[model samples]
Each structure stands twice: as structure tokens, then as C-alpha cells.
Target: MEEGKPGAVAKVIRRNPKSGQREFGDLVWGLLPYKTERPTTAVRPIHARAETVQELPMFADAFRSRRAIVPATEYYVRTETDGRAQRYVVTRADGKPMAWAGLWESFVWPGDRVERSYCVITVEANATIAPYHDRMPLILKPEDWPVWLGEAPGDPAILLRMVDPDVIRCEPVAQRRGNR
Candidate 1:
């Protein structure tokens, strides 16, 4: 997936309120057409900080009602080395897919058109990723999926914790991925 760009679609899994079953679908990368008090406001937030998602005006509503999980085999991060950008690929140490916490929203544009989009939730970096960046996606364990998807009735905030550093592996790679 293209990082930080809008319109890129990704597969996501979310809980269906009516059926109480997990449903899979494609969602646009960035939240858009968000309503604001000012008619000229333009905002497309790509990442929502997990620490304040429950209180942030842009994400609070979705955080409470539309939490989701983004399953992926790996993700990329960039760092500066010798004044040049260096890229790194991060994956689970056990060769398993990871579940990233996310929030989704449906917005209607001016012409009665509707679109659904989502943003990845990020938390402070753990020891493994701190050398590359100060923030990392909030990776949830399989056992915590039910709680995060609201299948169980516990506080979702508790699931925002970072993954254990030992469970993650990072490797430097060629910087040919894309422009940052």
C-alpha cells in the first residue's frame, strides 16, 4: 500500500453490528469529506494516535463505534542515514501476520455520495522500532482481537498497548520502495 496517500484501498476486517460476525471489506486509506463547522475546512488524517483517539474530535466517534483490525504480513518504515533515506521492513518474528488497530468512518460528500475510509492507529515506538521512528502502529495480539472489535464488553483503550518488542523483527532494505 502507498503510505500517507489518500485513495489507496486496503483489506480490513471489522465486526458487523447486526450479525455480530466478522466481515471483510476494502476501505480507502485516509478519512475524507469529514464535516466541520467551517465550510472550507479540508482534513485527511491518515494516522490516529492511539493514546488520544478516544478523546480526539476527529477520531473519537469512530474509535467508539467502528474499531477494526488491519491484517498484514509486513510494513515499511524509513529513517535518515548519512543524509540519505534508508528503508526498513518490519514483520513478526514468528513469521505470522499482525493485526493493526484501526478506526473507520463513513462520510457523505456534497453530491449525496458516500465513502468509507479508515486510519491506522499509532502508539509510541517500542524498543525494536524506536531506532527507526518514534511511533509505530498499534499491533494487537490474536487473543485481543475480540476485545478490540467490540465482540466483548471491555474497555477498548486497554487494547491500545504496544506489542512486545521481542515479537517484532526489523530489517534494513533498499530505499526503492517509494518517495516519502
Candidate 2:
């Protein structure tokens, strides 16, 4: 279990299914396994509401130590306006890829099988992404990558307050992003 928060189990691998000659059913959700105080089942909620990390214990620890940087060429977000959920692609105007703040952990099972999982951290959307949704992934500035993923532990409160707003630029995109 990463930082102690139960992770979402279904994970979408970065590989192209066609290249692997795999069926859609072959996909599996990645959930970080953890040892808890009781008989709690592992669950990968898949979608972590950026606003609720504090209430969820898993992120608390990772937010401090296991934090990571999730690199992305672009990211899809949904916005509801005029009664429809519109899809938006947020990218860098300069065309460079970016990374979102995240936390990761590795879990080993009974047969020496190891599972690595990650969760992107989020917070209230900045001015740029605010119009689209109330929450957005915490996009890390390149300069802060080392700090966010550094070996030293950080104070979650101080780190959470270090988001950069100007790095995100949102654009209207096709509704296909709304699909799972």
C-alpha cells in the first residue's frame, strides 16, 4: 500500500493493446496492496478526488514521502457547462510534455509477485483550470520535480501549497475523452 491509502486496482497500462495482440479483457486495474489493522480489502478507486486526500489516509503518507512525478504529453479533463460534460485537453502552449504530481508504492504478494502502483495528486484547480472543473491534477513545475520526488520527506501541508498555476492551458476537445 502506497503511503497507506488503498489504491485503485484497475490500471491502464501504457502499452498499446494492438501491439501486444491482447483483448480488451486482458487489461487489469492496478491497486496497491497494503497490510492494514484489520481484514480490509484492497480497492483501487481508480479516480481519486483531488479534494479529499486528507480524509483518505493512504495519500497522507505518500504525500509526504512516496510522492512522485507522472509525466504526460497531455491530460484529459471533463467540464460541465450548459448541461453537458465537455472534454478538454490541457497542455503546454510551447508543446513540451509535462508531469503531474503523484505518489507511488510497490506491493509484494505471497508468491513473490510485485505490484507497483501510482496515484496522481490533485487540488483545487488554478485560475486556468478552474473554469473547467473544481479540481485538477497538481501539475508540477520542472524545477520542483526534484523536490517533489526527492529522497527527503516533506511536510504535506507545505508541499501541497506549492502548486504552479501558469503551466496548464486548457482547450476544448472532442467528447471522446469522457469515455472510460
Candidate 3:
């Protein structure tokens, strides 16, 4: 549950500004726009909805051009049953790592103080996740990586609209007293 928590450092894949190539970099798990004054001064958002990523003020610029990918072996989701919370581990059926669609931002201040963070893009839950939650990260297949990362030519909006429900596999996790 603490894997992608805010303030945590995570490996991210985004286009290299200088070389226009894909590069691996570390970024904070929560998004902080350029307007933000400090890392902890704002309640940074960790997820951006697909339906609004392109239109909302918070995500428009990054969604349109600063897209990134978060490669993950698995992610957790939750549901409520009998007034208690149930958790599930979501992964690809083929066991390959998933490329979760994301957006990144960088903030630079005087004296070269720089900070970067990102947020996962969420789309309406597919059949596999509908029973557990209403939203899930926008999972980008390998083929679409280019377009999503701006490494190749293609439409990224089409990807945000929908994802095949059968792509991921989820398994129930046993609950612990203090885990949520």
C-alpha cells in the first residue's frame, strides 16, 4: 500500500528534452505544478482522471505534452465488503510489467532548487476492476508507449478514452488489522 505513496521517489520514463529519446528518471509520486511554492506546501494530487486530464487546468499542459510512463509489476485497489475494506493486487495476466500512463511536472526556483513529481492517469474502471473500484490507472500497452511518451507519431487521446478490460488480472488480498 505504501509503494506509490506521495513524497516517495519512483522511477519514471519520459521523453528526454534534449535528445528526444526515452529515458529513465526518478520523480516524486505526487504532482506539484510550477505554481506550487514548495513540495509539502500543497496537497498534491496523485491521480488525474482521463476525462478531464486534457481540459482541467491542473493537468492540461502535462497531459498534452509532458506525458510519462510508470512501469509497475502490480498495483493495489480496494473495495468495501461487510463494512470492512478489501484489497486486490492488479497485474497483467501474462505477468509482464504494466506501463501505467502518467504525467510529470518540474518546478525550478532560484539558486537551482528543482523538484519534480508525477501523477497516474485514471480512467473509468474496466470489467476486471468495476467490482472492486470505479477508477483504475490508464494502463498503456507496449505498442502505445511511443505515442504516449511522444517518442513516435500517433494520437494519445484515443488511448485515454478506453482500454481493453481483459488486459489486467486482479487477485484478492487477505486483510491485516492495521493495513488499509
Candidate 4:
């Protein structure tokens, strides 16, 4: 399975509302709200800010109900370094896969075809990533996965807390294959 990039599909885990069982599936990286007038990615967002995710019209509902987790081994980012562009790879220092917090939605196309899409959440960069970018993917710890996934009784306010910087590590890599 390939890691998700903007406009690409990625593996996801979401709690099934009816059965309360976790379901594993693939969802496109960009979110297309369920009742959008027409299908298009021009305005679809691949990332939602942690501060506004629950208040933003495009993502509020999904954040309240359709929470999901996108697992990945690495997160790549392109940023300027010494007046030149550089690629940085971010991963867990503990050697665990990242559980990225996200929201998923099902949009219906003209012919009534339903398409699933998701957007990763972002937060102010922690110490580990602050040098690379001002913002970074919101990674959830195992203990918080239940709340983020709506699988247990917990307040959504928990999301306001950012991931601990100690678990993350960043390395600048030569711009090469698989930059995305």
C-alpha cells in the first residue's frame, strides 16, 4: 500500500457507527464534503488546522462524527534551506508508525456514486519540526486514538493538545525519488 499524498489515496481506520467496530479502508487525501454541488478538488483541502478544524464549516461535522486515522511511516515536507529547497523526512523517534488525525467524508456524485475522502489535521509545529516548517501533521498517540476515532467516551477537546515533541525526529534528505 502506498502512503497518501495530496490527491492520492491512503489507508485509513475509522470506527463504524453502526457496528462500533473499527473499519480499515482507503480514502483520498482531499476532503470533498458530503453534499457538495459538484465533484471537484480545486477547492478541496488536504490539511485542516487544529485550531479551526472543529469550527470550520467544511470540516466541523466530519470532525464531530467521521474521525479517522491515517497511518504512515514517514512524513515528507519541502522547505527552503540555505536559500535552496530541501526535503525533510519526519518520523517517530520511537520507531512507531504515525497515527495522523483526520476527518473523512462521503460525497455523492451526479450518478449517485459515493466517494470517500479525508484531510489530515495540522498544528503549530513542535520543537522537533519547528525548524522545518511552521506547521506539521497532527500525530495522535495510541492512548488518544480512541477519542480521535470516536471509539470511546471522551471529549473532542482532547484534540487541542498537540503531540509531544519528544516522540518525533526530523532529517533533511537530498531531493530524490518519492519526494511527495
Full-model lDDT for every candidate: 0.84, 0.56, 0.86, 0.84
Q: Which ten residues in a row have the lowest lDDT in candidate 1?
A: 33-42
Q: Write the per-residue lDDT of candidate 1 for residues 1-180, one digit (tens) a residue.
A: 674356688888988768989998788887653564442365777789988999988899889889999888888888888999888999999999988999887677679876678889999999999999999999999988888999988889988888999999998765335544
How far residue 111's Cα lies from its native spot in candidate 4, in Å, is: 2.3
Give the worst 10-residue stretch by lDDT in candidate 3.
171-180
How do the residues 129-176 of candidate 4 rate in per-residue lDDT, one tens digit apiece?
888789988888888888888778898757755688889888777533
For candidate 2, the TM-score is 0.66
How far out, in Å, is residue 49 in model 2?
Answer: 6.0
- lDDT per residue as tens, model 3, 58-134: 89999888999999988888888899877888889888898999999988867788878899999999999889888
Return the top candidate by lDDT: 3
Off by over 4 Å in 4: 1-3, 174-180
Clashes of each: 0, 14, 0, 0
Q: Per-candidate TM vs. native? A: 0.87, 0.66, 0.90, 0.90
Which scores better on TM-score, 1 or 4? 4
Superposed by TM-score, candidate 3 places the C-alpha of residue 58 at a distance from the truth, in angstroms, of 1.1
Model 3 misses residue 89 by how many Å? 1.0
Query: Which is superior by lDDT, 1 or 2?
Result: 1
By TM-score, the candidates rank as 3, 4, 1, 2
Q: Model 3: which residue pairs collide? A: none
lDDT per residue for candidate 2 within 1-180, as digits (tens), equals 442234424232222223532111211223353442231356654345456665577666555455555556777778677898778888876678766666655566668766656676767877888787777767666665545555334444455642456666787785435444
